[model samples]
Target: MSGLKLEQVVKRYGATQVIHGVDLTIEDGEFCVFVGPSGCGKSTLLRMVAGLEDTSDGKISIGGRDVTRLDPAERGVAMVFQTYALYPHMTVAENMGFGLKMTGHPKAEVKAKVDEAARVLKLGDYLDRKPKALSGGQRQRVAIGRAIVRGPEVFLFDEPLSNLDAELRVEMRVEIARLHQEIGATMIYVTHDQVEAMTLADKIVVLRAGRVEQVGAPLDLYNDPDNRFVAGFIGSPAMNFFDGTLHKGGLRVPGLGDVTMAAPRNAAGAVTVGLRPNHLFLAEGDSHVVELSEQLGGVSYHYLKASDGTKLIVEAHDQSAPKPGSRTGLRIDPAKAFFFNAENGLRLR
Candidate 1:
């Protein structure tokens, strides 16, 4: 296991820059996840670390070794991509030991390593089965086992679960998390799913448009985001935003029945008020109309539209669900509200 560091890491294609200067550090044995929307350069940046994409500028180091210009094989990193990319003709054991065999490792040595990897991944029973005979999740485990046999310093996973079905995705997530804990390897995972990021990462690096938006533990980012984008992107169902005017006295938001509340210190003028779905509750009165309601057993989601046409979603824990087109009111928790500058989207301290 080893730590990885990126100093002003950058990537470009001709004159078009896809990744800007990004500085980050992943401590040894940390499960770090790079999360962002599509086209945000998360994959591009991961490719750079793998030495598969040229770093237009900047430095990348793994285990205290400068590998900025090193070849992919020399970078001491094993990558598990979105595709399984396993050999259909080879048995699971052969597929997992292929890398070592190609490098002239003795047959016995390769078998031992493959055996250990299979044990760790719970694929011992499937060793003799070919890729065609394995399920999607098992095939992916074979792919991961292949990487493990190489014993690289770092593991890079680029949306490794995207191809799996919903149930398989969840199953694979637990498998990967367990693998990380058992091996204690330094792993960098890239994904657009915030739920995955929140559940899997020890630390998450949130990116946007090739720049670092924020980096912190999942719950830290969710509870205290530095800007509007991070706040919206880090949480599931996303945070709800309301346009409000901040004055010396308080803040007024028409979307919440023209509600007024105390403003943060030194905040004034046009600001965006953010509230999580769970923070907002349904109440009596007809300030808004329920556009839709989703009941998922233990919890329900109410989609509402204010009289002024502002849309919002409220999460409720009860079984009661309002009917569509029904009049309703929203209750906001002032203490849980977040304020950001409307123009710049920066948090108001």
Candidate 2:
């Protein structure tokens, strides 16, 4: 269990810069997840930490040692990739012990380490089997077990669950979480899936276009995003954003309706109003849900369109859902509304 730190990290290919200057720190035994869209340079950042990709400029330190120019093996980190890179012909035990064997570890020591990892990963029953004989999840576990046998100071996962089916992904996610708790190893996981980031991370680092957007607890990012982008990216259905103008003591969603809030201390001009679908409630007196839908379940979503076609997604977990053309009332607690500058997308207090 070691801490990792990046200081003004940058990566460039030729003259094209991919990773902007980034600074972050992961505490010892922390599970930090890196999340962003494709081409966002998340994998590039992870690779740099692994010593697989050189940093264009800046410093990387692991366990208080500067490893900026060290080789991957010298960095004391083990990586698990999306593809299970187990040797096809080797048996599970052989594959798990291969690294130690190559490193000149004694035969007995290698066997003991491999056996311990197998037991920890529940692969003891499949030690003699080859990768071909194991399920997708089991193969991934073997890949992880191989890392564990090496006894690394930190674990780096690059979308390790991306290749699995949805159900298996969930199962493996729990497995990884348990591994972290049991082993207490510092881990840095990269993924584009927000759900994965939210579910698995002790802290999440949200990136955009190679720059750090926000780094915080999952619920912190969901409930108090620093900008409109962060707010929309961290949630399930995503927070609803609409063009609106700041008024005397509130904001107005043109065509749909207006919500008056406690006067913003220092607010003005045009702004974007945000509503999380889970927060939008169907009420009779003040709330107006313009459109509704029932997805053949107890929890149905309502898609309300303003006269100007501005859309809002509302969740009606119970009660009857309205038809597409039918109208329903909606209530938005002004305090629950998020306001961002329309032009800059920055939050307004």
Candidate 3:
């Protein structure tokens, strides 16, 4: 296990600075996930840590050693790419042990390490098979096993499950989590998928426009986002936001009435009211109803619009949502609402 620290890390391609100064501390044996939308520099930051991309400024330390300029191989970290970069000509065993071979380890030692990794990853059954004969999930396991045999201080995954089918991705996600627990190795994973980050990370780093927006546990980020960007980004249906003003101790929605709700700490001035889809409930005396309804078997979603045209989405277990164009009342949970500054998008009480 190893702890990783990035102090004011920056990455720039000529004058275009992609990753802004990012300072992060990943604890030993913790599974940290870097997540954001495309071009947000999540992958570039990961590559910087893996030494695939050079740091434009600041320092990167793994296990207390400054390795900001070290080569990928010299950093004592192994990276598993999204493509499952396996050598087609080599069998699973050879592929897993390739690094050991490349480093000129003894044949017997390499064989032992490969066998151990195979057993751990359940790749023993496919030792002699090439990448073509393996399923997507199995191929990914081979990729992970390849990293496992390296015995690196840290494991870096770059959207390692992106190529798999939905079901396969879920399975691999669980497998990766289990592997992290069993090995207790420090892992840094980069993905655009919030579900993956929510499930696998001990800490999630939410990024936007080359800057770190927030870093917290999954539920911490979900329940207490630092800004409007984070509040909207962390949730599934996403937190709903519309133009609203703060009035004394309450909030006023443009198309809706003055909502008597507590604001998040430090909230004042012109602020946007933030509420999650799940936080809004169908109420008896409300004035929003179904503009559209989508029923996905066990769960139903109602896309609603207030009398003045404010859109709201509600996810409910109620399988019988009103049909499109039907009017319904909705209630907001006062305590669950968040308020953000209109100017900078930061949370305010």
**Candidate topping lDDT:** 1
For candidate 2, which ten residues in a row score worst on lDDT? 255-264
Candidate maximizing TM-score: 1
Q: Put down candidate 1 lDDT per residue, 275-299, tens digits, no spaces.
A: 9999999999899999999999998
Which pairs clash in model 2? Answer: 287-329, 287-330, 287-331, 288-329, 288-330, 289-328, 289-329, 289-330
Candidates' TM-scores? 0.99, 0.94, 0.95
**Candidate 3 segments exceeding 4 Å error:** 247-249, 255-268
In model 3, residue pairs whose N, Cα or C atoms come closer than 3 Å (at least 3 residues apart or on different chains), thus clashing, are 264-349, 265-349, 266-348, 266-349, 267-348, 267-349, 289-328
The residue-by-residue lDDT of candidate 3 on 45-162, one tens digit each, is 9999999999999999999999998999999999999999899999999999999999999999999999999988888999999999999999999999999999999999999999
The lDDT ranking, best first, is: 1, 3, 2
RMSD each, Å: 0.8, 2.1, 1.8
- Per-model clash counts, in order, read 0, 8, 7
Q: What is the lDDT of every predicted structure here?
A: 0.94, 0.88, 0.89
Clashing pairs in 1: none
The superposed Cα distance between candidate 3 and the true structure at residue 40, in angstroms, equals: 0.8
